[model samples]
Target: MRTSWSPAALDAALENVHRAGMPGLFAEVREGDRVWRGAAGVADTATGRPVTADMRHRVGSVTKTFTAAAVLRQVESGRIDLDAPIGRYLPELVPGERGDAITVRMLVNHTSGLAEYLPYAYPSLKAFPDLANTGPQSLEDHRFTRFDPVELIGMGVTAPAVGTPGGTPGVYSNTNYLLLGRLLERVTGTTAEECITRDVIERAGLRDTGFPTGPYVEGPHSLLYEAWFGMIDPPRDHSVQDMSWVGPTASLISTVADLNRFYGMLLAGEIVGPSSLAQMRRTVPVVSQEGKLIDYGLGLYPMEAPPGRDVFWGHGGTVWGGGTLAAIRADGKRRMAVAVNMQRWNRLDSAGRPRARPLDDALAAFHRVAMYG
Candidate 1:
């Protein structure tokens, strides 16, 4: 909260960003004791709410860190086995064919061969469920957003298989994490929100961080705009869909400050001990990069590696109108995460042209300041 950011410079960079269809951008950077924060453009263009470090953002894939951490807690407590077939924990979720072959380790590594049935996204608001389930108070919660994990798995099962039955070396599937959530629920006898808050959020005393629900729409919310009905209008609000769509794989909403606390604690072994951290950071190799292959650790991307090797170790995720990427340094020292509500107000790209991936430019611009500079 003490670092000085070049506000004028960030604002100017974002102006061109808006022209490119990016809605809202916010970021934080930490190197040793120095911390830099930036917020460019309006969070809710229609409502004219200026972006701030405290505003909550839907950190699409970064949510994986939370889930992975929670699971490691279970492992630390001896509540679950990392190498056992996930079906051992939740038999009902086990696919008849390859269920026993898929292990918790595979799920974390995205090697479970379960092709993404829905990209862990809304596919559009119409597909979101009405909802049923309890949630922590910090978040307007939804446990069952539309279809339960069972139903979604059924849909995934009916579709063509991705890799061979057993997701071996390299297959990224959100379904694995969905099953992981179910497994966590079975092992802990609690919902993901309960575990996430108890093990991490609440423990860290994160105030403004949580999954927003109905009441969220009425308060200091970032207005999300989407070009609806093919109109070149302002972004539309996304308060309608339940936060559950984020799934265990990637649905987390938090302030820049809360994210800082979470990652900081993570590295300090506040939430988990050293052994559990190792379990979560372990990487598995994959070979699908055209003429290359690489390793993806639990909840993280590649960083740097051998030929066709990818050592990028961050987690990247996109959902509905939200996108995010977060990761710690190779040594798990310096950590960075970004969140923004890509609420589309105008259907056009600030010039009557249709928009695609509206927040792309904002993401790039914010990273330039927080990561590069």
Candidate 2:
């Protein structure tokens, strides 16, 4: 029989990850009946700080959940139409013009056939990479390198069209979520930042979730180390504020506790109606890692992990510096979230590049809560 791990086991594993590699990491695990939240390493390995639930970390693409929620809210309010050409609202964004024959649906589902950031990757990783400054760039500054949302939009414009108007699907392009973020900003008079705060955060009663307006909040925050690149030699020197410019595409930092509370409220209909939430979770077609069909849900990615009887639904995020994995069981009784400052999505092991489906081991530990720890 397969051995099951425990919450304690998961904690130990996280601590192992902390000691061996992730020096500045905090993990939060909320299971069916118990909760274990701990700071594995230092928030700032350099200065020595502990990570707290209030500690903020850039959520990266996980911010899509917030952007999705806002868009669905608009859909719920009749302010936007899912099938309505994204151009009806933003004419400059008309489909098929910029190699994107995407409707709002395609944009959210990552099926727009746009390039992902694997410019020099396994095959197709055109998710936006800077060819000009790939050499000796500070990890932090290299990513937060300033550019408006419109510039990000332009990145989508150049992404090679993979399929004929969403015909052959199966590429995870960050541009789709990026476009959704921009569309949300345009449809609403307020920016995605303000709307997410007012509509999603406050409404969901998520005290720990909020946007990083400027430099890191003058309080405790997770000081991440780029284990893959910025771990030694010359460290990426820049504040969290520098990375916030990614805006709806990436920005929107929050805590694990807040993320758990937010997703919990979302599943429980506390923040959004059933239809609106359903709209956000709308699943679409995509090629799986196995080269089979998979469900790339709207604003959310759902998959059935091994060793589990049921599917875990949620989203993950990746930035230049950090990565996050947040998931909730189908029953809504189990919710887990883990955010790590170490983003080595491109890390390669002996077998190949090791790709960890994360919530910082949140779900793995969460799975243990039922069987062992």
Candidate 3:
């Protein structure tokens, strides 16, 4: 028997999100044919506009799932080879023995061991935590910078590899996906965004999702705020900024309803053949910097639910201030997408350890409600 989803319970969970210091939170849950969407707090803190279920937000790294799916579509068409070395397609871009050693499979599963470029490109955010909030010049200077994917990959490859290619205990790197995006372009003779939209978004029938060509979110959306943790007098509005730095790795704009639909179709094998989906679900251990272990699949993360709840398969994404979690049950009978308009609440303490934060609690609560309800 399915547990009854309580609107009151969901509302309370969202209130906890707001109480945890986010400006707003929105979510959508689906079980069988039933759907539930809820919103809490203000979309714009200054105007007090309410967040709605339809509002678009930067779904961030969750875009990897779409990118991976698109690449897999090419795999099904014989246009790409999952086991082939990335160097085969983009010899000029990848270059050297490292490139030859890194296979498409390694990139998709984040086993390529490529170091992330963001910390190196935006060093201020990594070096000085205070600058993240104190109106650091680097933040503003780089916010609108249009970084080429090649340059970003250069930044990553130049850094030390996290481990050998196809190594165990995969280290998550945005750089791997950035290269995959470039690989898609090389193979399809189209922009990565175009390929993803045509092959994944369009195929999934996601009318509300698209790759934004500019910094601004079109249509209805909430104000995205980056909470710098008192570096500035108040949290900065980062809703507008070019996302090219991250490219297909984290630049997709979508709504909760669209996210749910995409995952639903994906988990049901409508986007790829059963064999490709099996490849996508191939498991690897992803160890966090803090030593937490999460079982990561090719494009998805299989999140173990709390006791008595079903396991969830999907991905979570975070941009400057916005955060999103999208998942479907193992049986594909239920799915959910949760969005919060604030980011960086999971701050590190003086010892460089993550401090206990309420946003974590809010997420856990929402997951329980989404699963059991």
**Positional deviation of residue 286's Cα in model 3 after best superposition, in angstroms:** 2.0
Clashes of 3: 3
Ranking 2 against 3 by lDDT, winner: 3
| Alpha-carbon runs more than 4 Å astray in model 1 | 1-16, 119-145, 165-169, 213-219, 227-235, 285-295, 302-313, 331-333, 343-362
Error of 3 at 50 (Å): 1.2
Ranking by lDDT: 3, 2, 1
lDDT of 2 at 151: 58
Score residue 330 of candidate 2 by CA lDDT: 64
lDDT of 3 at 53: 85
- Superposed Cα RMSD, model 1: 7.4
Which numbered prediction scores highest in lDDT against the true structure?
3
- Backbone clashes, candidate 2: 11
Prediction 3 TM-score vs. true: 0.94
**Per-residue C-alpha lDDT of model 2 across residues 1-373, encoded as one tens digit per residue:** 2334355676676666565555556656666556777667766667777656457777877787777887788888887787766666666744456333467777677666665433422122212222222332344333434556565666555656665445546556666666676677777887778877888888887766777766564456665555442223433424354554456766777787787777777877777798777776767777642245677776676656556355667777766557676776665756667766655423334443344544436435443443233
Provide the clashing-pair count of each candidate structure. Answer: 25, 11, 3
Worst 10 residues of 3 by lDDT: 127-136
